[model samples]
Target: MELLLKPIIEKPNETGSGHIKAAAPVRWALASLSLSMLMPSLSTSIANIALPTLAQAFGASFQQVQWIVLAYLLAITTLIVSVGKLGDIFGRRRLLLIGISLFTLASLFCGIAPTLSLLLAARGLQGLGAAMMMALTVAMVGGTVPKERTGSAMGLLGTMSAIGTTLGPSLGGILIAGFGWETIFLVNVPLGIANLLLAAHFLPADRPNAKTMQGRPDAIGTLLLALTLAAYALAMTMGRGSFGAVNIGLLLATAFGAALFLLAQAKVKSPLLRLSMFRDSTLTAGLAMSTLVSTVMMATLVVGPFYLSSALGFDAAEVGAIMSAGPLVAALMGVPAGRIVDRFGTHRMTITGLVGMIAGLFLLSAMQGRFGAAGYIGPIAIVTANYALFQAANNTMIMTDIQPEQRGVISGMLNLSRNLGLITGASVMGAVFTFASGVADITAAHAEAVAAGMQITFIIAALLIVATLGVALAGLAFARRASLLEEVS
Candidate 1:
């Protein structure tokens, strides 16, 4: 894989085009890429704040309303890896511009969507655009920045994403209350256009390697991955509502599709996933930790809103405000955590982060129903801070250890792991809510039951963090062993 893609890095040299000469252009490039990256996170949460309004507008159930959110996520999660590889093959700039254009169009459609089905379709389109932006952003940064500064660049980018996540719900709530639910989608229009313009002007072209660009995309691999991911997403989205014949079929198809995809990948000459990348212990450990982190994060996001609106009787605006706290802390702490990774190394920071995360989850788990807003605030803040640290540290560890040539693929894999974890987390938590509430209904009583389920889920999440801490410890021990072995040799 490295050999195949080596020409991409070498081509700029051959063309006498050194690293991007002007600082202004580089900064603009970074800003555009970062903004594009911010869209999906913002879109995801903005809609959360508008869910109740959307439910009313479309006369939809909670389960049906969730599709508005899940549609985009499912599309992006399924396509990110495939699109990232395509960017590596074709051109990152080209893909990015196309993505931004599609995103903008989708946003417009979303704003005007008159029916639930139409809105969901638009959201899925938006996810396709998001996938392109996400796949290219990190790869573009890797291509543009000096090797020494890449970590810092990545850190800043991560911080921006955290900020977007923080802002989305708050902004969404305000827009929904003042203008209506449609304004959330409308909000993306100006930002998307600006990003598109800036990217065209400032971003460098992806000079593809001859070997990699020679062949078309692996069709069989692509189909298998798509089928697998779609099946899994269906099983997740439909599992809670009506587990009838169709749902059962979807779940069974998901199992078969996943199996076939893995088998197909192994046989393909240039596999989409490049399963061998897991050979690196650092990558393996990081991926495992990442999966756990994402699962917890997703569950908390999905469950928190339910808890706030149903359990605590908070309005959409209040729920958005409360939910915003964690991302706010995460945004603040992301850069510092990256700096810590630069100084202290990933292992120590990861272990510390796990400890903090476990502590936070435990605090959340222990919250009593009688506790007021003040009681909830402190624990939620702790959880957010710890999560931010873990995210920054984990990203640094994963990217730093890999070969530069593999950055795009690794980025895709990392994202895939996180998204898959999120999907799984939502499913698991949804199941808990379903079982605990004893029906698909969302009522005050059901809300309390949901809270109980969340409490149990948080405990399980905390245990996962404990398990991750053990993995971190094991990694440290292995590092020591490698060091000793090198010295003796």
Candidate 2:
């Protein structure tokens, strides 16, 4: 047992405290962390591509098979923060191991499930595992690598996430066409096993933190927050682009649940989310900018397809090929973006990224069909590359010096904000495109109408970038003022 659990050779961690810095161990640790980030993101997109196949296999309706995806999404959205808090209370290493095991087992179950209900159940379980992985991976980064290289680590994780998301559709398609839909789920088995072993071997041992041990888990706060997030996710997703009574009711429930959750947090002896954390202007600004930037990014995803297909008369394959550039650019830029952040600082790089996004979006807003695919791809690449830099900078800025015990929950909150933005963008931006097109049915909108809609939608998206830029600049100014005051005192 001692041999099996032997600690890796140690070196200085991000805090200048001792952890693993040996090249081999650090790379292995990074590999495990990268896999943790990849699996959840891959799961998010992979299932969408397999829905049709799953429906046929199970003799299910579109709505029924949709649960395979929705169940996973809802579980992650609702439970991510709660699981993060749990990791802090228990031990991140232990909980992360359990998460990997659950995800692996759930994948096996999902692959072989004979019934739709059974598949959905396994998918929900998989989502629970994903929530744990997504929440803790970033939190674990500070403990895994050197402090000066944190940005690079963040960028690597970002790159892995982009790879997972971008690879999913193509991978799922290949697996389904060659083997079957089952292979899509089954594929995770090998990767999950690899991740588990590497993580078990390479991750730092969880230390005994007296502060964390003394704190009680906030059960009421957890329940209320989960319910609130579930409501919000449902409200954004349920209508499939149209808002109805159910959507309205869910939104109302979200608002109510949020209020109750906030009240509960205030009253709880140990809150799931500490309200005081928001007092840090940097943290608050970072979270706000992340949400805003994510929302704008989603605009590209939602509107790009329609504009390419309807306005430009591109075929499905062409539209897909062109759209792939954004994620491809993001994936390629992640590491370089981190290096830039490391070299120039998060504040400067963040401002640079936002400025680049504004320029891309403004160009997109003025786009005309005469310029063809090159016009669209050019701006998207610029936006995406800069977005990679911005995300790396923002994440590093937020996660850099946070309290160790609070790391898990803070990471979860950052992810949650980004998720909320994506959900909002999918619905709201799509609506804006449709409304600007002056058409009830966007799918069949005329070329000129579609082009007009794309322009207007991007104009709105550019405004969002401008708002995010404001937050970044204001945060910088505030930080400078505070630093000056500290020096004067």
Candidate 3:
């Protein structure tokens, strides 16, 4: 820790433009930020792998233990924007330190909790901490790295997220086998400590923005938005596979809550989200594309395992190995994707990435079953790599010129769109797969049925990508028109 801290503690010398020029300090700063990004995703995936073990340990049912994951996800989703607004008001650095501290402590609490309820509570608290980190990390990039390299920074963070997600299952399995389930939560403690230290020492101190600091944050708007998101998330998630009366009730509540939230935002002294930000075609389109792309990507996770094991007759270990390829491809491609964005420019790269994804999805949807695992892996790899590129470019496009005062909230919205996508994809794509397979029970489905489901799911996923590509083109057209009008004026 000392060795790592010594070089940076002296204070990184900044260029005249105020960005960090020293590669070593810049690397360390990114390392701290990378860990911040890693912890939440790691915590999520690691806990997922341990759910069965936890259910047995606590003598609980699958539904009850599932809350352990849902609670964390809900907390992050509902509170992410609110926390981002708070960071914009308070100070990103200060709030980030508090968040890291809270996350680390929560991990410890989760590790030691004797009751399932206590663990779930701690997990929720951990999610709150994660909300602050996820919202602020990208927002801080402008302050940390040179503006030109923002895409690279975004890519590196994406890589860390992939690494954390990819590493979790395998690591959790080993930790559970060697030291039991508690160790999975406990393992975060030391890494969190390291992350906290590096972040506190290296990340840029927040410069107070007088514009954003003028008034107190909108408490009423915040509550309404949070409640609305929670309702929507529950509506999508609670039904498992079946959307019954409860799901319909929740959806109604979500719609009603959203109306109230929008009205409240317009009237509030300071709003959780400025309704006017949506006027920016780029931001609006970027958020839409993000949500759409994320929803499509979730199809891979929701459908991959069942297809591999049932259709291909792969064992659990083989299924796990095949599934790991997506994240592995993401990790490997992240930096290169970012570099490509830097060289080619964000708008062009964003389109190129989407195009690549469309091509990959077409292959997945139409490939001959006789080709087997190689066919699946090849197309999925193409999708994953393009996703990395799209994410970096799209993030770079939206984040590059955002007002400093609005950065935190904008970043939060970006993440919120992705989370909502994942949730929607899990529910929607799963339903589609089940409906297409012609089986009431997916587990008992025949191999040909499973293969048909996989192909049908990918076809829908490809269509979604095509729709996202249209969004990208529309955004570009909007930008050009706006520029022309500005010049005329």
Candidate 4:
């Protein structure tokens, strides 16, 4: 390792404090990883905007059209961790290469599908491939970048994702207008092929490491984890439309599956997820806070369109345009915010972000009655910027200084928390809005009632954020005390 790094870096005597610049290869790896990450995220967002066009193309019903998106989401969310574990076992690079190949092939199938069913099947295949790529992209980025600059590297990756997600709707509209819905999926083909060639040429070979799992992957644990995620995600997705006994049963089954998964991991010789890793209090705290932040931020996204269109009487097109501002701001600020995290540390940036989110939520709540969606663009921008900084920093805070081998599972855990948070945030915020509006029929709700409900929803969101802030502060204190004790010892 030292030999590989030596040629690319200045000597410690020459550079001040043993600082090493990342090699050309490392920079290439980061760029490659970022582009790889961007495509999957962009694909999802683009697909969302193309759904109406697809429905018309296939003459599909609302439920069937919805499945086109849900199938991909479900497949990706459920399989992310499992594939991450596989990366640790076989090799991330190998898994990544395979994933890109599969994704490229799946996109081809999606583009030429003769029927809606085939398209949905192709989408699911595409999601499976995306899951593998997403699972390892961050880990690979961390592996190659200089340790001191991990936050900055991650920030760059986040920026790519932010841009991809935020750019999706407008890009999709343009493609669908000038070309067709098929163009969206087909657009990925060339990009995927180019990325594949880049990966094949640039990325270093993955070799056996001390950190790779030695024995067979945990079959029972894998099954249980899949079940738990599937049940939970499905329950959350289904709950929005129907909150009946089946949904309740699914929720119960999710809990049951989770318990079994925990038990299975404990007993397994080589567990898919290493439960022991949580022994690090920092990792636990970061994951918990990540879950909370994801819940609030994503839930805010869930409500934004409804608030804009239903309450503020903005057109759908206008709502989409305004909503893009937040993510665009996030994309713009991501690298700078990450540099700050590298300079100061995760705790300070996270606290700053938490405070910003609370302020943004309060501002949104206060201004909704007066300025409505017209006044929302700036506040949401602030909120997303806070999220960008917090995510870029806090994500690395737990795994940043850890052993390289542990990265696969840790990265997977991070992804899992974010996905789980999105589901939780959307569900909780939806329930709060429903209760506050006192309207069983969302489509029929009065504009005044929706406006009132949105305000209450923001207030509730702010309160939840406050609780997360408290826990994060406590965790920060704990880490400081531990550092002091280590110094004394």
- List, residue by residue over 1-489, the lDDT tens digit for candidate 1: 122112212224446766434555666777787787688778877787688889999999988998888889888888888888887777778888999999999999999998999999999999999888877787777677655455455666677788788788678877888998889999999999999899999898767656666556788888888778888777766756446787778889988888888898788777777778776778888888888888887768767777777777789768767777777877777666666666676677778888998998899889835576655677877877777777767777777656544666677777888888887777776566556555556454565676776677778878888988888888778878988999999
Q: Report how far off residue 235 is in candidate 2 (Å).
A: 0.5
- In candidate 2, stretches whose alpha carbon ends up further than 4 angstroms from where it belongs are 1-21
Better of 1 and 4 by lDDT: 4
Q: What lDDT, from 0 to 1, does candidate 2 have?
A: 0.89
lDDT tens readout by residue for model 3, 412-433 = 9999999999999999999999
TM-score of each: 0.86, 0.95, 0.95, 0.94
Candidates arranged by lDDT, highest first? 3, 2, 4, 1
User: Highest lDDT among the candidates is held by which one?
Assistant: 3
> Mind sharing the TM-score for model 3?
0.95
Compose the digit string of candidate 4's lDDT tens values, residues 1-489.
233223323325454776445455565566678777888889889998888888899998777888888888888888888888888778888889899999989999999999999999999999999888787888786666657777777777788888889878889899999999988889989988888887887787776465566777788888898888998888888856447898889999998999999988888788887888887878998889889888888767877888888888889788888888888998887777777888888889889889998898888888885765557887788788888988888886866877766666677788888888988887777888877888996668888888888889888888878888897899999999999999999
Pairs that collide, model 3: none
Error of 4 at 123 (Å): 1.3
TM-score of 1: 0.86
By the lDDT metric, which is better: model 1 or model 3? 3
Root-mean-square deviation of every model: 6.3, 4.2, 3.3, 3.7
The TM-score that candidate 2 achieves is 0.95
**How well does candidate 4 score on lDDT at residue 323?**
86
